[model samples]
Target chain A: MNWMTTIFYFFGAITVLSALGILFTRNVLHATFLLMLSFFSVAGIYVLGNASFIGVTQLLIYVGGILILMVFGLMLTTKLNGKALVTENHNRLIGVLLGTVFFSILSYIIIFSANFEMLKSNKTLPENAVEFIGINLMSNYLIPFEIAAILLLVALIGAAVISEKRKEKQE
Target chain B: MSTIIFFLPFILIYTIFAVYGERKISAFIQDRYGPMEVGKYGWYQTVADLLKLIQKEDIVPKKASKKLFLIAPVIIFTSIFCGFVVLPITSSWEGTLTQNGVYFLLAIVSLDVVGILMAGWGANSKYSLLGALRSVAQIISYEIPVTLSVLCVIMISQSLNLQEISYQQGILINAFPDMENVKNYLFGISALNIDVTNWGGVFTWNIFRAPVLIPVFIIYFISTLAESNRAPFDLPEAESELVAGFHTEYSGFRWAIIMLSEYGMMLLVALLGVILFLGSWNTPLPNIGNIMLANWTTGEPETIAGNLWSVFWLLSKALMWIAVQMWVRWTYPRLRIDQLMSLSWKYLTPFAMFLIFVSGLWRLLMI
Candidate 1:
């Protein structure tokens, strides 16, 4: 009905399309690329929701940081001479059954969930909302913020330990 | 104006100028005549190059993945356009939705790495894969420092929203020197020496305020160079080993998108430098430009001159930073991968943590 809804639909379409691409693609790398598309579209959805900071962080950290790491790990460990890059499940019936079950559950919740209407409020423009997020992160979430620092340090050390292959003493 | 959109050729023409500028700049720096042959000052060289890329039969290698192979370029081009949304272009030169702008802008940006990774993997070549992997490692490692450094700014300014961050920085005057006098000026009270230069953050654009931030800035800028895939950190496509890096199999508009995304990324990193390191849209002096123009509730200055001036301020700052990046890129030789890792993990990582600690202290003591 409004501009925001229009944007939501557009991004939502892209998200679904990319998700479909992820499901249909055979190549692992191709699937990853589709996942990138899905991630970006979801970030767009975040922008639409007015949580611009979180959306950008999601992109920078997830697509840029984590996914890249996943792809790189795949590259490093992959035996390229192998026949097919894409891997799929042999049993489609069980897979489809599980997929349908999950899909049905989600749909049932969406359709049957009562007492709430999808009435949208023009809560914020994108830029203003981001500013508020910044404020809240500093003033309110300071503890979590400090904790995030410690977590990053732990991650850094953990990654170092895992990746650092101790050289065996040559006989 | 929509009329300007019709002149897409104008953008094309601007490409020629961009090429000439690049040539002329590199030439000047190297003390050579760069491009004098093609249409004087080699202005036509980029057009010539464009024509060449256009004429070259677009090739997709036989072994390459088809779907992702084609889509890679499209994603790059689309992603590059996203940065413009949040960036405040001159004083009054507001571009698009400034709200939720950081996410809209940065999300599209980080996606470029995905494109690079895809370009590498889709090529189905050893060189492509190697380059892609290196790019992945390099981007991820450097990203931590870059994010941490940016966090310092976010913490100091207390905003994740880019536009508001820009607004919050605004030129603050040091009233502490004359606090006794200033207080007098404010509350009709008499002069007290007060013993401070507005000691907290009223002065020094973060740099002057926290001189200790210099190391963090250095670490950040260095890692950011890697994050933007600049030289020294550009090990993924190191020319001697991998030909053209991950883009080896790419051709046609796809290659164009790749290059465009790259330059666009270069521009983004530089602009972010302007925001974080430089005073952003704020002038060095207090109360010189109209801060009110930044607040969107009041429409941007209606006059063309006013809007143009603000746009001037924003662009000038961004360009100055780009120049700095170029200077650094040309001046430094590429770092080896091991060296690069050591710099991030061993040096920058620890150094950034220390900077954060120091920043906290500076805030406690000064604020």
Candidate 2:
């Protein structure tokens, strides 16, 4: 295989391993860190696939933004009582069942719906993909984009109100 | 790959000198002689310190998480170093020619937050944990203003490529005939009949190209100061309150690595600021009437003299900003955490948002 294929496999392996690590790791912080690894490697895979704008955005939003906040929340909530922070696994059977079902559905969709010929063809994206993506977002995907943005705004306001109420109760 | 080869040694040499320079600058500010005995004018003091650090013991506390503790500095250094990959050093020499280069750089550099958190949490020290939390909060909050200000530049330049942004600031506008509208206006003023496409200098820079960007530049600088954890926004490492902050428990070469990354970050932001606002790799000297100073200073793109001039201009501008950062650090007292938060969320963020709106209007006018 070529260098690109080798790099793609490398990132893919890291993504899978990190996700597995997250599932198996007892320490909540370790699991969270592994999740970051998973997200980062997924971004790498996106870059490898020529979706560089999406890859960078994934890094920006997921690893840099969401993961840091997740780590912050975990750190603040965990008691600093000089003990290793660990979480107990519960309802393993049901969890396994649900995970398997979702995985199977995703695999089935990929196997049946996705064009394997297109994957093999390896068509490179436009040179100015950022501009292309922006135009598409503004014109073709504007409604979906606006809807998602509004949903996020609503979630943000709800979070603020909920936290404000908590402070009031505490006072 | 070649850029990485060049930058690795550059970073090493830069860190050594920068440490010494910071000491001398701080000493001068405080009216004290800093490290006069180590070398000629204390030139090799930081080198001596690096040697000492190398020889010292690598200490990991008994309660520390061994794996994460061991890996934290590596992660921090790697993340910061990766940011250099997207930066263009000269006209012909860029690390990567990615379309979304600035976005990629910003995103990768921010990943150092995870590494800082790892260092703190893995250290199992109260001081380290507190410092890390403060740092994460400060960096993340300041990032909004930084991103918005950068977005202002991207909107004005209409490209996310750092090299493209750099080209827009120089006499190279002739190479792109599509920028005819830009060539027609001098400093975005249609009333000014003079065309400045051939006059490469500060006049062609983004701040002057669109004057609304001046405040945006200021906001960017302030926020980047906080993003890099420099004073007066350096509550994370306020020595008085949190010892040495997130790396308090780290010792020897590990601590040195952390210091190296900190300086690297400072240099990174300064370089980025220079590229985004000031003319990147372009001579500030304008071609005045009957004198082609700008033309003389900025050599052709591929020639040896041109490459040397480009590297010189970019580094000199970036270093000037670094000197400013050090000056600010020594001059101002560290901000209180609450005050820092308010400054970022209450003032800088809101102001940056407004600037983005203004930038959009200005861009419309330019069109």
What level of docking quality does candidate 2 show? medium
Name the weakest run of 10 consecutive residues (lDDT summed) in model 1 chain B. Answer: B181-190
Model 2 global lDDT (CA atoms, 0 to 1): 0.87
Residue-level lDDT tens digits of model 1 in A116-137 = 4434453454435655666788
What TM-score does model 2 achieve against the real structure? 0.95
* Tens digits of lDDT, candidate 1, B63-163: 87766677767766566656655676544444455544444554566666666666776678888877877886787678778767876765554454455
RMSD of every candidate to native, in Å, equals 6.5, 2.2
Off-target runs (Cα >4 Å) in candidate 1 are A1-3, A13-26, A75-79, A113-159, A166-171, B1-18, B31-39, B95-107, B169-206, B209-213, B251-253, B284-304, B364-367
lDDT of 1 at B357: 76
Q: Residue B253 deviation, candidate 2, in Å?
A: 0.4
Model 2 chain B: weakest 10-residue lDDT segment is B176-185
- For each candidate, what TM-score against the reference? 0.78, 0.95
- Backbone clash pairs for candidate 2 read none
Worst 10 residues of 1 chain A by lDDT: A114-123
**By DockQ, who's the top model here?**
2
> What DockQ, on C-alphas, does every prediction get?
0.57, 0.79
